[model samples]
Target: MLIGEVARRSGVSTRMLRHYDALGLVRPTGRTVGGYREYSAEDVRRIFHVESLRSLGLSLKQIGRALEDPAFTPSALVGDLIRWTEDRLERERELLERLRAVDASAPSGWHDVLRIVELMQGLDSASAARRQQAVLARPEGVAVPAELLVRAVLAESDPNVAGALRWALVRSGGDVVAALAAGVRSEDAGVRRRAVRAIAAMSEAPGATAVLADVLGDPDPTVRGHAALTLGRRGVTGAVPALVGMVVEGAHDVDAAEVLGTLSRDHGCADRVLTALAGELAAPNADSATRIRLTQALVELPGTTAREALRRLAHDEDRAVALVASAFVTVLDERCREDRV
Candidate 1:
């Protein structure tokens, strides 16, 4: 076939075929009387081979090596091409994500679009400080997309940056409770913790109370404890048992005691709190240390139930328990006396 017929049949342009000849990539194997370039079957096959390699992102020089060099191993070159393709694919995915975030923000102008892009980039930044500044520096009135905020809050590892992202999520509010709840269910303990922290930080995280109520049942004690404490503070009586457990385990017992005290202020839940505490206190296997922590937690409870429990504990067999309970009974007596006057 002549160059024209070869170009027509192979779909390689005439100019490109000539360029290939110049580079000695696919030289014509024949010539006509008019001295025009002619291609034999083997040459045509080589032309198709070059085009096939080019489709895999091989540069012309690389293709030349691949086609002509006997020593050129395709394994290494193909692996490099795979890496390059992956890098390009990742970049495109990131760009698509940014476009989605920007579109979700509903930017009214180029300025808004740029601002949201900058904020999203900052949220994903490697430096914790940059991430924090990204959240804090959001223009006052612009609503940063909630999905971006949710992602940042879930992935943020730095305490300060996480706090700022959570604050931004709360302030930017647009139905983030579902995303946060998903975080609470994450298999990664750190992610679950961050999710709960973000949810608890919201003044009114929609569905947060319900999600946290479920989190109260988490098998991880730390997760359950944090969720219970937050729920207790919110006056959810279901947290009383977990709070009492915290006191028994001596994990964040002080904070748990304080929140339980706050919950006990509601007369409806006070009995439940006192009963849970008394059960832990009276358990036969309850160690002396657990009893001591329980006694401390009782100081936060109101009504005669705790005071009466203290009075019974005052004469207990354990001297340390007697000493602590006796001291508390005296303090309660003094406070009652002062109230009477």
Candidate 2:
């Protein structure tokens, strides 16, 4: 076939076929009497082969090596192509997310779009300070979408930056509870912990209370502990067991004890709290330090049950626990006597 017929049948443009010939990628196998280029069947097949390699994101140079270099193995080159494609896909995904965030912000003009884009870049900066500044320095009255803040909060590892991101979410006044709840359910423990911490600040948000209630059973003890403390302070009685567990385990036991004391304001809840504490103190495996921590926690409870529990602990087997419990009982006695006056 002549060059025109070859281009027609193969769907390769004449200019591109000529370019391939110039590069020795697919030279014509013969010439006609007029000295025009002519292609044999094998030459047309090679043209198709080059187009096939180009479809796999191969550069012209790589395609030349692939077609002409008999020593070239495709395994390494194919692996590199896979990595390059993945990188391009990731970049595209990030760009798409940024565009979505900008659109969600409802930017009023090019200025708003540019500002949102700059803020997003700062949030993604490697420096923690820059990320924090991105959140803190957002132009006042420029409403950043809560979804963007939610993403930042979940992925941020720096404590200060994470706090700023959470604050920004709160300031945005968008309902982020549902998004943060998904983060709470993440398979990554770190992500779940960050989600829990961020959601902890949204206690009054609609659905936040329920989400936190569910997080009480998180497999991660840290996540459970944070959720428990937040719920306990919100006057949710369901957090009592986990709060008591924190006291027993000495995980933020002081804060746990304080919240437990607050929950004990209710007469029925006080009894439950007292009973749980007494059970832990009486456990056969309860160490002296554990008993001591439990004794300290009892001071927060209000009622005869707590006082009587302390009175009993005053004579405990462990001398250290006895001393601490006795001192607490004496203070309770003084306070009770003062109340009588």
Candidate 3:
């Protein structure tokens, strides 16, 4: 059948089917001799699965990955979702009890305001976790639910959004962060990339440092950069090694460069990052922009450690980079002059 027929049987429109195709949610099985699209009974089955999950609030990108495996279990996924729904329900219940004991329609405090949102289905922990993942998982050009856009905007407005989110991740450290990390594992590159950025920002939360470690090998350089920056800012000294690797692979990108600069500022992390930068600069494939930035970072650091690292990199293959490193050392080398530790 053509896309129109598939759309008719599936109750989804042709344009949406096309969008699904773009998201890899559903694709025709074959093409006709005249170049029209053709689909099979199996394609119809796939569409049914996609539509079924969509009704349950799964994003097209999520449904797309679920369909690739023969062993995929929709019931199990639904059960997980149902559990999340139950948790959200319970939290709202507690919030309501607190609200009723206070004045009519007036929030007693920040927690009271939060409780009202919970009652209205806006601040459910499980639901927020799921919605965040869904928003992060949607492919580029795909439309998102309008309410999500509003919440994301509001989340930014609170100024303490990061603090509140960190509190949530810490308070419910296990499940919420687990769902978010799963979004980062999405096969849709866009989904994985955005999710990783969100995860990176959450590293200060209880379980988040571990979560960022797991994604250090993410396929996209952009995701890795964000992850590296997040971990660096969190100042995970243990993560210094993995972040060092990302910095090497992503030397040309400014995000990684900035992270390395931060790591250099951290007295404990500077040595490892500077050593890693030195090795990367000597390698034949290193980016010139990257080498310069690393050298400049080394020169800019106030610590005696940074100066020593600069001295070592002064013999780099790139003459310009080497000259800068040597001159920086010459200027700041005095700081290390008096019996440096």
**TM-score (all chains, Cα) for each model:** 0.82, 0.94, 0.44
Candidate 2 residue pairs in backbone clash: none
Tens-place lDDT digits, model 2, residues 1-341: 99889888989999999999998899999998999998999999999999999999999899999988999999999999999999999999998999899999898999999999999889889999999998898988897889989999999999999999888888889989999999998999999999999999878899989999998988898999999999998899999999999999999999999999999995249988988999999999999999999999999998788888899889988999999999999999999899999
Ranking by lDDT, best first? 2, 1, 3
lDDT of 1 by residue, 1-341 (tens): 99999999999999999999999999999899999998999999999999999999999999999887899999999999999999999999988988889999999999999999889878888999999998898778897889888988898899999989888887875899897888898999989989888888872566888888998778888888888988888888888888888999899999999989989886378888888888888899999999999998889888888899999999999989989999999999999999999
Write down the lDDT of every candidate, Cα atoms only. 0.89, 0.93, 0.62
User: Which has the greatest lDDT?
Assistant: 2
Off by over 4 Å in 2: none
Query: Model 3: C-alpha RMSD to truth?
Result: 18.5
Task: Between candidates 2 and 3, name the one with more favorable lDDT.
Answer: 2
**Best of the two (1, 2) by lDDT:** 2
Q: Can you tell me which runs of candidate 3 are displaced by over 4 Å?
A: 1-175, 245-269, 300-306, 312-317, 330-341
Model 3 quality (TM-score): 0.44
Stretches of candidate 1 above 4 Å error?
7-11, 68-79, 121-130, 219-222, 278-288, 315-319
The lDDT of model 2 is 0.93
Worst 10 residues of 1 by lDDT: 199-208
- Per-residue lDDT value at 89 in model 1: 100
TM-score for candidate 2, residues paired by index: 0.94
